[model samples]
Target: MGEIKNRLRKDLTAAMKQRDDFAKSTIRMALAAIQYAEVAGDQARNLSEAEEIAIITKEQRSRTESAQTYADAGRPELAEKEAAEADFLTRYLPQPLSQDELVAIVDAQMAATEAELGAKPTMRQMGAVVKAVNEKVAGRADGKTVAGLVKARINS
Candidate 1:
């Protein structure tokens, strides 16, 4: 019942009314995934906004990976379908950080870590830097990308 969840429901209804089969199906799948996440564990609970965003992010990632697998298997049609679904779900997530923004964040975190250590942070401290960067990035950038940047910055 969060904003994005409500938006997805409204969009699903709109898609159905417009006779847009693919959008309707994709949105339905997203909703089903969110609902499943809600009931996934010991007790039923409403998802906080962050939790809802995480579920949507997970669903989007699943579709993107599925699309890649289908493409690798040479199924262009199926790949396109999954890719479209992933793109649609992106609306519910925050915009990804641009590369320059990402670099600035990593650099800032590296500096902070360096200050804390009273010396330039070495690769050994990459984990701390990455953790700090991730906290600032707040899911906007992929973890691997952040780690790679942090490693490169440490090396340089």
Candidate 2:
């Protein structure tokens, strides 16, 4: 198993020993998700770090969506639970890039592309810019959010 997976298992055991219901449940869920992927893939090997991140991101996105839906339905308690679980998952994730950091990445990408093309890139070049920026900021920012920032920068 991956190092993160092992660590999570250890943490889960500790949570169980300490009677931390939230932590125990959250970690168990993450572990189950990882195991499910491995079983589905029919691979004996563990997930790579990137694969782990992808799995966690998928879970986090679902939790966020559920929280939003619950809140909209006037279920604040359930929404809070979902949001808290999402935050717990995020503790295992790399810190998300700040707006300033994202801006810097976008600026660097735009400059590089401009220098290479000898012209300011148009909206049509948004895809290329976003692709490059994602490569630079992978695991630190969401692709869709980064793409939006890149598009706005190009248009500006």
TM-score of each: 0.89, 0.89
List where candidate 2 sits over 4 angstroms from the true fold. 42-44
RMSD to the true structure for each prediction, in A, is 1.7, 1.8
lDDT of 1 by residue, 1-156 (tens): 678789989999899999999888988888898899889999988887777877888899999999999999999999999999899889889899999999998888887888899999997898888888887877688889999998888788
With a 3 Å backbone cut-off (N, CA, C), the pairs that clash in candidate 1 are none
For candidate 2, lDDT tens digit of each residue in 1-156?
Answer: 787788899899899999999999999998889888878854666789778877888888889999999999999999999999998999888788999999998999899999999999998888899989988886788999998888788778
Q: Please provide the root mean square deviation of candidate 2 (C-alpha atoms, Å).
A: 1.8
